[model samples]
Every structure is written in C-alpha cells, then in structure tokens.
Target: MTKRFMTTGLSRRSVLAAALGGIAVPALATRPATAALAVGTAESYVPIAVGAGGGPAGSDRVHVLKVGPDTAHTVLVLVPGMFGAANDFRLLARDLVAQVPGVQVWAFDRREESLADRTGFTTTDPAAYYLDGHYRSLDPATSAFAGHWGLARTLCDLRAVVLAAAGGGRRRVVLGGHSWGATTAMAYAAWDFDGSPGYDQLSALVLMDGGVRGAFAGNGEPVEDSPEQVRERLAAIDGGAVFDLSLSAVGLGSRAESTQIWYQLAGWYAHRDPDGPSVLQPRMPDALRPPVPVTNAALLGVLVDSGFGWPNDISVHSGHLAVSGDVRGWVDTGITPISRVATAYAGGPEPAVWEWYWPARLSVDLDVADAYTDTDLTRSLGLRLFHSGGLDVPLFVFQTSYAQGTIESAAREVVASSRIPYAAYETDNGMNHLDPLFAAPERNTLTTSLPSFITGLR
Candidate 1:
C-alpha cells in the first residue's frame, strides 16, 4: 500500500479545531414544509405511504410532505443530497409555490422510518444502514448483491413517491435533486422500467449542481485501467495511519454515525470557498467546482466537531477565472456557450487531496478502474437521454459550467447526440457541486435562479 499520512495528535487537533468552526452552515432552500391557502384554505402535512406491497425485503414506509395551493397546476418533487433530510427542501418548496402561485410541491424522506429513527433520520449513514440491513449478507449464489439501497432501488423508491403523491391521477410532475439526489433523479429518468406504471408520471427533471455522465459511472463497464491497475492505484494512495487517526479521534461509532459524519464533512469541504468565481475555477479541470469556504467549513464542523475552524488553503488559478466567466454568461442570458462547468466542479486540489488522504483515512480504494467504470456508467445512462423511446415526456436538464468530469459535458453531449426536444441551461454565478441546493438564505442568487428555470419550463 501507500505510505499513510498520520495526522494523529496535532493534525487531529487542527482538524478538530477547523471542523468545529465550520458549523451551522446554511444553503438555499428547495422545498416548503407548510403553507396556508387563501380565505377558505385547507392545509395539512399529509403522509402518503410509498412502496410496493406491505414491505419489500428492506423497504420502509416513505412519507412525503405536500404543501401549497390546493388547486395547483403541477407537482414538483424535490430530492435532497446525501445525509440531508426531507425537510432540507422545505424552503425551496415554499419559494417555488410562492413564485408559481398554484403549484404543489412534495419532498419525501428517503430514509426508511426504522433507519431514520435509529440515525435520527439525518443524511449520514442512511446508506450504511441500508447496506447493513439490506445488502450485508447474500448467498452470492442466489442473490446478485447485498446492500440496503442501490442507485436502482433509490430510483424506484422515488418513482413510487411520485405516483403516491399524484394519487393515481395523471398530472404534470417535475423532478429535481441536488448532488447525489440529482444523480438519483437522472437515474430514474434514464431507467427503462418499461412495464412499470411509475414511468408515466414524470414530466421533467432538474439536475442542480450534479455531476453529469462520465463522472459517476461506478458499476457499468471496463474502460482503460484493469482491475489490477486499480489495485495498484489504491496501493499508491492507501493511508492506513490517517484512517486510524480519524477512526480513533471519532471512535468506531455505528455505521450510521460514521456515514453521517462523512457526509457532513464532505459537504463542509464542498462549500469551503467564499469567492464564487474562485470556487468556480476548479471546475475547468474536472468540469465542476467546489462551494464557498464558509459553507464547507460549517458542514465540516457539524461532522467533525461542534467548533472547527475554516481552513485558508484556497488555490488561485487562471483555470477558475476562465470557467467562472463562462458560467456567468450562460445563466444571465439563456445561451449555451462553449463553457466547462463539470470540469471546474470536478477539477480542484481538494478531490485530489481527498484521494491521497481517503485511502489512508477512510479505507477507500479509489483507483483508475473505479474512475473508468464510473465514467462508463455515466456515458451509458447519458445515451438514454437521446431516445425518447423510454420516457416520452418533456425533459428539462439544468447544468452548471462550474461542475467537473463528464457531468455537464456528458449532459450536453447526450442532449446534442439525442436529437430529442429538450431545454438545457447552465448556471452563471459559479455554483459548486453542492451549491445549487445548499446555498444559504434559500433566497440568494443561487436559489432564485431555480424558480425562474422551473417557471420557464411551465
């Protein structure tokens, strides 16, 4: 393996300090929790049951909160990022309803009630618990794999929630997600669930600060690096000592706790940059960018300590300036210029730094093989956007030039390659991978842009 970096005593202390200072970070709101009707208004936080049958192998009763005008024109379903609770979208929902006048918005809790209760229903560790409960044990002989929730299952669950919210009636439905949630939204859209009834309810999809095609292909095909090559790559970056320190400082908590902490920390790091333009710079390399430093610090503090200090390790490069300017031009005017958001979002020292530290600190083996596979998966799914054969509905794809990898590019490529009628746009104000949904005030420039995008769709 690789020589591990040991941030044992002093490093831990510094990290703890930095993490603590980064708490209470806020982002834009994407959903509403409660709303009042006009004079004779009737409002209720109705809990709609979602899932096939009483309970599948590892299924839980999903609950969605719907709030807005009773006679709404369309239903918008918002999905939160990893480690985020359904309530995270409340602000966004409310804002959309206010802007659209008669539109209903629904945000669902993806966590199974049992898992939610055990982990306090937060964003972290939901996947771990899902894996432990659903996919931990498998007779490889009979079962394909063992994990509580995979991309496919999550997509199915989302589809179920949408159908339940519609109450069997056909209506225009807009689907949106932030970060991993955005991935989930795209997966559902690209999924070829032909015989299933859920496919019919989708009207549009919104991908906010989410990576495009080749950036997230984890389990599809082999591209360049062989499995052996990936093993070698992992060997180069494995940091056992760092992981030991991290685990020791944090302690070996429940899978849920550990996962939750990881999510919070990742979020903290993503939003660490304050200057939007600077944050947008990294995307040029990866076609994606990171969020503001304040946001990243707050998220990290919540995960690491209750009082972490924000780090000042921001990098200044010409790549950022070029990408930031491109993104700004795209959003201010509905124009598709030759810009690179996915590259900027994905480009950055942080992800590379994480690659170096992650193997040692988290025991993750990210190799070229994994990267290639992820890219392949992204490309495969991207191809689905072309043929309206599966989902015959109006498709709205929102891309930001501040992202990295093949996310924005692949999305653009798919749109261009598909010859399908679609509405695609890129954000200009330099949003990072998670900024579209996690920006503060829920009413800032970032959040404001979403309503207009959705309204234009109507």
Candidate 2:
C-alpha cells in the first residue's frame, strides 16, 4: 500500500460530511471510561528521567521525560509506531504507572531530529528517496548496528537505564514498544550478543502489536522485487530517465497539488463508516486504489510463502527451519498450543478498527513517501528470520477479530501449524490494526494480555 500524508485541505469537517453523508454521529460516545486497577499501598510512584532515542543515526543524549516513582518494581520502556513521538503513549503510560507503582516509563523522541539528520538525506519528494538511500547503505559490517546508536548499541542504552533505575536493586524491567518500536524490542531479543558485554540484562519483552516479518527474513516465498526495483522498472519504461514521468503524466508537480489530492482521498476514508460489522473495514479513502495493480503480474512479484520462509518440511533445526511450511499449517498447529494456555485468561474478542488513511502526513513535509515501506520490508524480513530459527524465544501470539482479513488470516494460519509451545489470546473487544496502540482506554487490552503471558515465563 502506498502511504500518503493527509493535508490541511482535507479538514475533518469536510471529510466527515462527504463520507458520512446523512449518518448522524453515534450518540454512544466511542470512548470508554478508564479501567480502575488496584494500586498496592506498599508501592509508591517515583519521578525519574525516562530516556528517549532518536531515529536511526540519532544522538546520544536521550530525550528524558519525567514519569512514575523511583520505588516501583517494574520499569516499562515504550516505543512508538512510525512517525510517532514519545508523548503518543502518555495516556497509556499514565494509567500503567498508576497500576504498577515504581514503574519507570520511557519513550523515545524519534522525530526530534530531521530525517536527513538521522538518515543522511534531504528531499521533499514523496517517492521515498530516503529509503532508497538507506537500504543501499546496508552492510553487515561497519554499519550503524555496530556503532553507539546502532540497534545493539541501543540495547546497551536500555540496560543502562534499567540499572540506574534499580540502583543496586533487582527489579523487573519490561521492554515494550508499539509498531516499529515493538519490532525493535524483538530485534534486540534476537541480537547475537556473543561479543557484546552485559547481554543478559533484559527481564522480559512486550510487543504492543508489533512483530518481526517482511525484509527481516530471507526465506519467505519470493516477493515482487523491492519498491526500489519497481521504481527502476518504471524508470526504464520512461526511456532510462530517473525522474518519474508518471507524475508528469498525472499533472501533479508541486507539493500543493499532491497534498490536495492526498487530503481529499485520506479525509474521506478516515471519516467513512463501514458498510457492516466485519474484519475488513474500508481504511483507505475512496479516491485511492491499491497503489500497485492487484493483477497477476503484481501478485507474481509480491506473493511468496507467508511464514517468513520457515520451511514447510520440518527436518531442519527447531529454530529458523522449523517454522517454515504451509502458512495455513503453521497458524493452525500453533494456535492450538497457545489456545490451551490462554483459555484460562482469554477474554472475548474486543474488535476495534482504525484506518489512518494519511499515514504519511508527518513525513510528507520531508518528502519521505517510503514511511510505510519500512514496515512492509520489516514484515517480509520477519517472516524469513522467524522461520529460519532467528526467533526461538517463547512467543505469545495475540489475534484480534479487527485485524485486516489478510493479516488476521495469516496469523491464524501460522499459529495453527507451529510445533513450538506458545500462548494465544483472541480478544473480546473490538480492536483494529491501529486501535491497539493509538486508542487510549483500549490500550490495556494489550498490556494486560502481555503481562499475563510474560508473568508465566520461566
């Protein structure tokens, strides 16, 4: 899916009117009252500096936010989704700290620095010049992962935060993240700490609705060539010129023109009501079609084995090769194991759905059209890595009815086929793709489910 930024032209009022037409706003306010949790009298909330990290290649100085009390036993590190800042978790963090006293909450300011400053490129074109530059620079050795700000380097930073907060005391430190941040925490768990000092520090990990997939792995069925390849093919079609002649053909040149077109489309979808109660609600604006043609040509290029490429034949070691197999088999077998354990605490599915039609709004000013590409690549990578034994750790797969059908089905398939032991929970509430993290009151559905799984970890 192509990511576009929502422009001011697509105001909420105008979008709502167009999308909803005669429908009246539901009198039943969607917002639910905050759930009350028992704050133990023995624990106290303490004020502490919560550290934040810049996006890739960011600075060393953590953007510290004050949260919680020092006497709490659990420290939670919150990571945000693409284009999200530390404050996005404020409502959820406030509630979490209140329940688990002495909980030190920290979130990173990924956007504090310009994308250029962090990724080393500058342009305002929404065609993803930044990602093109980034992947081109990926080298196993001498990459940022080895540097102070690399992924492993960030793990060190996290360890420091936990130790300082503990102050010679042993406390439960949980690494939690939303979207990309959640993937980062998972990557940290997968990091090869053979040479890194102080590797065994993390007590637990929480993936708030994020997991490894896509480009993180190499084994999945072959996808259509990467987006960079698609751009190249398009360029070739235009007589070897690097510029996108398609834009010229469409008569969209200035940022304003693109913004206007994007806003109208995004606004409509963002405000549109679903035709019925189902897993797949229309999240995209009516104006936009799937960016790429959903044709045989396109499917051939992108459709591959969904299990991130874990071999279907289970002769290989239990790590990477074990998860590989028929996508349906994996999910089918895997779900049974988790269902056994989750049945005790599993609640009915709370299905909620959100369509951030203009996901690229924040990055559009910087001409970063590939804002969502990273996620796509990440999902691809995750499929391959997890299947190849890169992810052998205990995993708790949470499925909600609100997920896009394709994604939800894929999750179900993988869980059913897996041989390893894990837990699965199908929520009772209406939780959608974005609602798991973006919605405030419903966030507990995620936190509570996670702690229940982790607290049982050996």
Candidate 3:
C-alpha cells in the first residue's frame, strides 16, 4: 500500500484522481481546480450558516454538497442515516442530477453536537462522531432532551439549511432522507412549531427505508433503552467494551468493503478541510486508523450498544445484533469479534477507539424513556411524525423490502390518519437499510421513482 500526501487546499481534480485509484480526471472549465470533489464526480461543498437554533449559538457552519446546476425550480435536501454523512450521498446525488434534469440534489453535512472539540472527529469521521456527539451534547438545563434534540429543532436546522441552499426562498424545497434521516424527513413533514405545520416549508416528503414509526413500539409506546441499559452503555464507553466486529462484516460484507466505505467518506471529509492539518496519518491501514479518525468513547458506546434499542443500525442484519442467532449467537460463543480481526488497530498501545469520555448520558435517550414511562400520553415527547398531527401536504413513503417494522407501521399510521393525499410505494428490492442510498443497482429505481414522485407533487 502506497501513501498519497495531499497538499494545502488540494483541488477537487486531484482528490478525485487519487480517490479513484489515481484515475486521471480532467478539470471542468466551470469550477476551480482545487475544489473538493466526490470520486468520479465534481460535487463541491457549499457552506450554509445555521445560526442560533442549531445548538450552541454563533452560526454552526453546515456544509452542503450540491449536484447539478441550481437552475432547477425545486430542491431536494437529503439527510443521511445513522453513520451516513453528506459525502455518502455524493455519487447518488450526481447520478440523480444526471438522470433527473433540472432538479438539484443537496446533501447536508450531519449536525454535530456543539461541544468544544479539537479531535477533528466531526470532519474526519462524522459517521461515528455525529451519533456519539448527539447523545453527549444533550443537557437537562436547556430541555434539549425534549426540545432541541427533538424533531422541532431538527426542523429549525433543516429550515436554516434549506433557506440557505434555495438562495433565500427562491426555489421550492422537497426533503428526503434514508434510515434515520428518512424518519427525520417525516418528522419535519408533520411538525407544527409556530402554530402552522412545518410541511408548509416543503413541497413534499420523500422517505427512503425509514420514517416516524422507527422510534415507536408496536403498541404505540416509545421504543427506547432502559435507564439501567443507558448507564451500562455509558459506562462501557468509559471502560470500553469489546464489540463483535463480525457485526460490521454483516452490513459492510467484508473488511475490504468496509475500508472502501470508510475511504470514500473519509476522503470527502479530508477534501472539505484542506486548510487544517491532516487528521489521518500516512497510509494508515489499521482499519480503525484508515485516514479516518476514531470515534470518542461515548459515541463508540452508543453506536455499539444503545439508542432506540437498535444500536449499530448501520451494522448487523435485521436491526437485531444482540439476540439475533446468526450474529449475536456467534458473539456469545466467543467468536472472534469483528473489531479484532476486521481492523488491525483494534487494541494497541494508545488505541484510538473510544479514547475520550462524553461525560453526561444522552438527552435523546432520556426523552424517549420519559415518553415511554409517562402516564399522560399528551405529555409524552418523541418524534413529531409519530405524534398526533397527520401531514396535510403530499407525503411519499418508499418502503424497502427490509425496512424496519416500526418505520413501516409509522408510515401506515400516517396514511390512516392523514386527511390529505398519502402515497406509499412498497418495493420488493431486497435492500438492507443503507442500500437505497449507496447501492448502484438501485440507481434506476431512485432516478425513476424519486423524480416522478417529486414531479407528481406539482
């Protein structure tokens, strides 16, 4: 393995060339030579300042990648799932733009928990950091557990970014998300913050593989981890627990597959931050240290163990890693944990895995637990989509074959409750959670189904 060094402000052309195994990509006449780009594509980052509402004041800089020209009348803002970051959607966004002319696709960088940090985890390894930082950023003082971290504030952040992307409300916006992002999109649709529904801000909602029901129990109860479980997980973050790396192999297929995934994502992160010193070392193959920074202790724990009772949604099959016979059974039998063999950087002197402590327990977890235990149903706090109000605007749900049952039920519930037109497209494609966004085979489905869905909104 040869190490490739990036100079200060490496251009998109150079980044793409190196990312594609040194493929020579010609520079475009329209854009600058040193722009950060996706592999084989020329998507560049546009910074959107989301002020105030987006946790910890002073305008959090949320970078959005724009694909295609902004001449399109409507903008589709897609948020990524658990570990899914903006760069993950680059290839898909480029493909969509090429396939669906006149419609621009914008993918948002995940919002980080506003904590003072110098690890560059947010920029280098967002998938692992955002999930952890979110839980760590929760505080009882500001009511973030129920308010800021909830869908309402999320909508605020989305609105801020949408407005910035649309160049001050010039274009109509349609929102879409995959997995957890899908659920976020649905929440934005049903949210009623200022006496009016947030749905008014968007033209339509495109949910891929997830939605409101993802956080709810079958009996309408909030799905969450118990306080004891949350505590244990938090402790695990401090003490560090050995996770089954085989679980990662399930979703990513193999170590090489996982490396590619990390490579693409890390490359995007690195490209975006050309001015800062490189967070990754020279050709670090220690799977954990593959140019991508390791997640903090809290984030690693939350990602590996808890959160909505379905931790590591990005990894493992059927969303059940603990009890599932295939994966967990192997873990119980002392099968070599995936973390051990999947990457050589598992445990060593000064290991990068879970190096920092997140201190407080996640507010989002407490909020969900409170909603579950509270006797007064009205007082319960959770995602807006699962709440009472049904969307009045056009709602489109794309339920993949292996979509979570909670999400499926939530979509059905919204359909039953919605007085307005609600449509659900159930496809037989055997896609695990993340396939709809990353899998090239499904590009046809996305290009055809999504564009038509958005156009139908007109």
Candidate 4:
C-alpha cells in the first residue's frame, strides 16, 4: 500500500560505494533509492541439502540464501538458472524485502556449485585467476561424482529448502526462478513429492522469462533426448569429463560457459578498479577482445551489453561505454546499472554468482522434459514433474523480450487446462534475460509487480 520504494524528487546519481576499494552499488542515485537499498540487507546462508553422494566436498550440502526477517509470513524460494548460484538473485531479494513488509526471499545454490573454486577471487589481484591461471581450476576428474547430480538429486535437495521456507506448514511459500531456474520451478510443480503433488505445498508460482511449453508436444515423434541417449551421456560423465561449461545447444558455441568465469573476473576488475587497464581483455581471444584497448568496465559492457557490438542472446541493455575516455568508460542505462551487473559478478566475498562447474547431467535429464511431469518416463528419469496440468496455485508470469514464445505457450496451456487464476505481463522496453533480476528497484518490473501478486494470492 505504501509507495516507499519510489520517490518523486531526487537529483544525484553516483555509482559504487567506497567499500574495501570499490563496489558498483548505485550510491545516492538521482532517481528513487531502489538501487541503494540493495546494500545493507541482512543476508545469510544455511545448508539444507538432502540426498546421498553428491559431488565435490560440500556439494552435497546445498546452501539456501535467506534475505529479510525470519518473521515474514510468506517466503518466495528461488532457484538460479543453468550454471548459476544463489547470489544471482541478491538484488531482487533486497528489492522484494524493501517493497513487501511480510515477504522473504529464499534462493539456493545448485548441487554442482561444490565444483566452483572461489580461491582465485580472494587473491589481491583479480587477474591472478585469469588467463595465466594463478588459481588452478578443480580437476574434472575429481568431480566424477557429479555424474549422479541429475534432476532427481537436485529436486530432492531443493525440496528441503522449500520445506524450510514452509516452516512446518506455518509460512506461505511461493516458488520461482530465472532461465533454467524457472524451468526447474515448473518441474518442481509437476514433481511428485513422495505421493503428494509439488504444487500442493505452495501458495503461488512466479516465472521470470522462463517456462515449460511444448516440451513433448509431438504425437509420436521422439523427444530431444531418448532413454538410450541419456544412458550414453551418463557413461561419458562417468569417464571423468564432469564439468559442462558447454552451451553449443543454444548455437552460441562452447565459448559461452567456458568463458563464464572470465565474466566473474571481468566484473571483479570493473567493480574493484573501474579505471584500471582491462585484465579480462588479455585473456580473451583476439576475435572477442575489444578492437581498441579498454578499461575494466568497458570490457564488461562489451560482454553483456549488445549495444557495444557483441551479438548474443544473453546481452541486456545495461549501458554503453562512455565515448569520451581514451580507454573507454561506463555509463549506466538506469534500467540496470552496469555497476550492479559488475557487482552481481565480482563485487564481494559472497557465494559465487556464477557456477563454473555446472553439472552436465542436470541439462542432460532436462533434454527429455515432460511438460507436466505426467508421463511414466518422467518418473523414471527422477524429474518427478508428476502433474503440472493440475497445478492449482496462482501463476504469475512476466515475459521478457529475450524469451517469450515458450513462456507464452506454457502460460496459455496451464491457464486453460487447469482453469486456475493467473496473471501475465509483457516487457515493453528492451529487457533481456538477466534484466528482470538486476533492474533498478523502482524500474524493475518484478519489484513493482511481485508484492501485489504475493498479497493478492488466496
């Protein structure tokens, strides 16, 4: 009811507070104080992992990030996308807490995160873990146990997080996620928890630019990954190549995930030393490197902002490199600050924002997706998506420009078949895959709409 998240007359806009050195947080921004509100939140992580024999040392103990007061009545549990960690939703969690008086956000790091080596992030120089390889990555051989980190294991562990959020049925819970995380939400809804349907435990669902459409929409034609194909992939994982930084399926090439850490380092450099010479540049191939020598922020802008000329679907409208600087500078688009993007990647000692060692099996199991978890094969694969069509919880879907087709179809099918109450909104401005989470507090569509959705639920 209170519009405290937005203010009318604010004139100064600055970036990053003087922390240990730098943090691209929008300090005293000219607009509403939404971006500034991101900082100073009480955040903590607690291990709530389930299942047996997970990868790495502590990979079995998945940590759920808890933001906001424990007294909040409603909890929105979020799962990150492919190769993602809980910190990915840090901005959104802070924003949600600011807007709603009674809501809390619970986000979790996936199982394979145990493979991410954050040892490099602690070094004095961000580039210590860069191309020269000062921080050696985990040997894929050591992570052979990830071969069993499939949807089944993930769901079982996530169920523990959800149950903790539920607080022994005392708190109302809403489930949600981004990209692959959103798809995981759908799978969880369809999933059968013991004998009970997954949807029975939640009050509502929030899908941000991710959904399940016609995964197996064909009559008799085979799905993307058959049972035999899944078996062969598992055999390969057993042979030692456990980490899956490959993203060839998106036509984006294997370079996508392989260079994901380059972003973590790049973001750190940008936030730590915005004006410093680009540490990420030297590590990049000649083709991907900026044509002209650039600064740390400029290199980050090049990687994520399409306006800077890199052509990829993951690009969002963060801002452009300042044209005047001889070494190039960054200008925040105001929609999502470039500094926020940098902070999201490499700001502090928080849990990793990117999962460098994404389990190959989770993606493999999803290739044979069952839209509603209504198939016998779905149970066999451990997906447990038992009955999505029967979902009775309120559905809130916010479609973005980057990935709308599948979300639209999925929203339509669920609303029609289940005849449940639902709300669907479209992104008018240029919003990308990652924008919904990082957009400025007031300008963020989710921050503005989610409170009403959560409160409106019956």
Q: Report model 2's TM-score to 2 decimal places.
A: 0.45
Residues 312-363 of candidate 4: C-alpha lDDT, one tens digit per residue: 2355667665545567677775477778788888835557677766767777
Candidate 1: C-alpha RMSD to true structure equals 13.8
Point out the worst 10-residue segment of candidate 2 by lDDT: 344-353
What clash count goes with each model? Answer: 90, 73, 8, 6
Candidates, ranked, lDDT? 4, 3, 1, 2
Between candidates 3 and 4, the lDDT winner: 4
- What TM-scores do the predictions have? 0.52, 0.45, 0.54, 0.84
Best prediction by lDDT: 4
Q: lDDT by residue for model 3 over 153-261, one digit each (tens)?
A: 4566787776665676788888888755765666566555556566767777777765653433322334344555545644553443311122243232232124323
How would you encode candidate 2's per-residue C-alpha lDDT over 368-430 as one tens digit per residue?
A: 111212245334322111221223334454433322232223333333444324545445234
Q: Which is superior by TM-score, 2 or 3? A: 3
Colliding pairs, model 4: 12-30, 190-385, 190-386, 191-384, 191-385, 373-385
Residue 33, candidate 2: how far off, in angstroms? 6.2
Rank by TM-score, descending? 4, 3, 1, 2
lDDT of 4 at 37: 69
* Candidate 3 TM-score, true structure as reference: 0.54
Against the unseen true structure, what C-alpha lDDT does each candidate score? 0.39, 0.33, 0.44, 0.68
Query: Which consecutive 10 residues in model 3 have the weakest lDDT in total?
Result: 327-336
